[model samples]
Target: MNATDPLLTVEDLNVRFPTRQGVIEAVRGTSFSVGRERVGIVGESGSGKSMTGRAILRLVRPPGEVSARRIDFMGEDLLSLSEREMRRIRGHRISMVMQDPKFSLNPVIRVGEQISEAYRLHTRASRRAARQKTLEMLEAVQIRDPERVYQTFPHEVSGGMGQRIMIAMMLIPDPDLLIADEPTSALDVTVQMRVLAILDKLVQERGMGLIFISHDLNLVSSFCDRVIIMYGGRIVETCRAAELDKAEHPYTRGLLAALPRLDQPQARLDVLERDPAWLKEQSVVAHV
Candidate 1:
C-alpha cells in the first residue's frame, strides 16, 4: 500500500473470547483498511463485522482478547497504545456510532449536554463553547429544531433524531476516523436513508475515513466506495461498489440472491447455494 493509501490498516487481526467451553474466535486474521474511502464490512450475525470495529478501537473486554501483528492507524501502532493513551485517541481522534442510538445515548441527560461533553473532552473548550459546537453539529445532521432537540432527553426524541444526535455527538470532535457499527439499523427505511446521507455528507466535507459495519450487503453496495464481504470471521471477498454485481465469492453471491426486490414478483426466490469449498478454504487458513 502507498504511504497515503490508508488512514487505518489492519493485518492479521485476531479476536478471541475464552469461555469455559473453548476459545471462540470472533475475528480471525482479518486484514483491511480505510483511507479517504468509505469501506463497508458485511456479513451474517456471527461473522465478526462488529468485532472488527471494536478491535480497531481496542474496546474488546477482558474475556474478549484482541491481538494483531500490525493494526496501524494514521501510521501509529494501535495495538501498542496504553489504556490512558487509547482513551485520548478513542473519541477525541476517532469516534464510533454504536448499533442503537437509545443504548448509545444517555437516557436522563439532555442530548446537547452529552454532545458538548464529547467536544469538551477533546478540546479545552468551556461549556458555552462546547454547547455552541454541539448545536451546530446537530444542525448539520439536519435536525429541524436544534435548540428544542438539544434540551430533549434521548427517550423524548424519535428514533431518527436519536440516531442523528448520536451522529452529532460522534462528529463533534472532528475525528480522523469514524466507526459506525449498524448506526442506523434501528430506524425506519426512510429514516435510514436520511441518516446514511448525513454520514456520507459529513465524511465528504471533512475528508475523513469511515468504516461502516453492517449485515446489509445491498445497502453497502450502493452506499460505500468499497465492500469487504466477510464470512466465518474472515474476509471472503473485496470489491468495488459498482462491481458488486460481478462478485465471484459464493458467500457474496448468496447474500445478493437473498435480497427482496419490488420489480419482479418471483413466486420463489432462489435461496443461495452453499458450497462446501468455501468452508474448506476457511479450514485450511485456520490451520495455517
Candidate 2:
C-alpha cells in the first residue's frame, strides 16, 4: 500500500441499543479513516469516541447493535467478517487498550502470564518463548526491572505502571492497528507523558496505525497527526492537528474556547454551548 492509503475506513457507522426506555444511539453516522499515523478522537463524556472504537472492533455485545455502510480494514470488510475471522484479526492484526487497568486486568493471573497468554494465543510461540516476549514487551514500554514486574499481580503495580503493562500487552502481538481509549487518562502528568512517548516510539518504529480517543483537546492537538471532534454521537469536525485551533465548526470552536490557557488565566472558563443543529451536520472528512 502507498503511504497515503488508509489502513482502515469507517463509513456511516451507527451503534444503537434498544433499551426499555427507548432506543439509544451511542454512535450515529460516524465516519473516518485511519492511516499509518496518529489520529485522535476528542469529545466530552457521552460523545461516542470510545463507542466508535468498540464498534469498529465488533466488541459491542447484544442489546447493542452496530451497523455500518462500510468498515474496511486492510482491504477486508470488518463489518462483514465472521466472529471466528474477527477473532483471528483481533490482537493479531488489531488491538485495543481500554481505559482503567484496574478492571481490564485479570486479578487471578500474574501480569506476565496475562501478557504471555495473549502472545501465545495469537502466535505459535511456546510457553518459554511467550514469557521471553512478554519480558521484552515490558522492557520496550520502559518498565524497569521487567523481571520483578513479570511476576507481580495487577493490584501490586501503580496506576501508571499498570497502564504501561496494558500497553505492552496490547502491542505484544505486533498489531497493525491499535485503538487506545483514554489509555493515559488515569495517570499523572509525568506518567502520561512517558506512556505517550512510549506509544509514539512504538507506533513510529513498527509503522502501526493508531486511534487515540480522549476528552482533552490540547493533548490531542499536540500529540496526534489529525483530530476528529465528535458531538452528540456525530463527528462535528475533522482537521489537521496543527490547525485545530482554527477549526471552523461552531462546536469545535466552542470546545477550543473552553480550554483553559496557562498564559491567559481567566476568573471563569467559558462553558461550551451545544446546538442541537450541529448533530445533523454532515461528517467532515479529514481536512486542513
Candidate 3:
C-alpha cells in the first residue's frame, strides 16, 4: 500500500442484535477511514462508539450480527478472511486496548508473564527474549521499576499501573493499527494525561493508525487529529479536531453546548435535545 493510502477503510458497517422487542441496530451504516493518525469517535453512552470499534475487529459475538460492504486493512479485505486468517491479523497486526484492565487482564497470572505470553504468541520468541521485550515495553509506557511490577498480579497493581500494563501487553507485537476504547476513562486526571501521553508517543514513534473511542468531547478534540461525532448509532458530523466548535449538525452543537467551560461559566449546562430525524439522516462519512 502507498504511504498516502489509508491503513484501514470501513464502509457501510452495521452491527445489530436481535431481542424480544425487536432487532436493535447498535451501529448503522457507519463509514470511515484511518491513516497513520489519531481519529476520535465521540458520543453519549449507547451511541455505538464502542460497537463501532468492536465491529472493526469482528469481535461482536454470536446472536449479534455484523455486516459491512467492505472492511479493508492494509490493502486486504478483512471481511473475506477466514476465522483462522483473522486470528493472525488480530493481535499481531491489530490490537485493541479495552476500557477496563480489571476485566481484560488475567486474574491468576503474573503481569510480566502475561505480557511475555502475548509477545511469544505472535513472534514465537524464546522465553528469555520475550521477557526482555516485555520489560522494555513496560518501561516504554512510563512504568517505573518494571521488574517489581512484572512480578505483581493484576489485583496487586493500582488502576493506573494496571492500565499501563494493559497497554504494554497489547503493544508488544507492534500492531499497525490500534483501537483504544476509552482506555483512560477509569483513571484520575493526572493518570489520564500520562496514559494519553504514552499513547501519543507510541503512535508517533511507530507510525501507526489509532482509533480513539471516548465520550469526553473536549478531551477528544484536544488529543485527536480528526473528530467523528456520532448520534443514534450514526455519524452526525465529521471535521478537524480544531474545527469541532464550528460543527453544523444540531446534535453536535447540542453536545458541545452541554460541556461546562471554565472560561464561560453558566448557572446550568444546557441539556442535549435529541431529534428522531437524526436516526434516519445519512451518516457523515469521514475521509481521513
In terms of lDDT, the best-performing candidate is 2
RMSD of 2: 1.7
Better of 1 and 2 by lDDT: 2
Ranking by TM-score: 2, 3, 1
Query: Candidates' TM-scores?
Result: 0.92, 0.95, 0.95
Give the alpha carbon lDDT tens digit for every residue of 205-272 in model 3: 99898999999998999999999988788887899998887787767777888788778766343554
Q: Which stretches of candidate 2 lie over 4 Å from their true place?
A: 267-278, 282-288
Winner by lDDT between candidate 3 and candidate 1: 3
User: What is the Å distance of residue 275 in model 1 from its true position?
Assistant: 9.7
Give candidate 2's whole-model lDDT: 0.90
Worst 10 residues of 1 by lDDT: 279-288
Worst 10-residue lDDT window, candidate 2: 267-276
Q: Encode model 2's per-residue lDDT on 41-66: one tens digit a residue.
A: 99999999999999999999998999
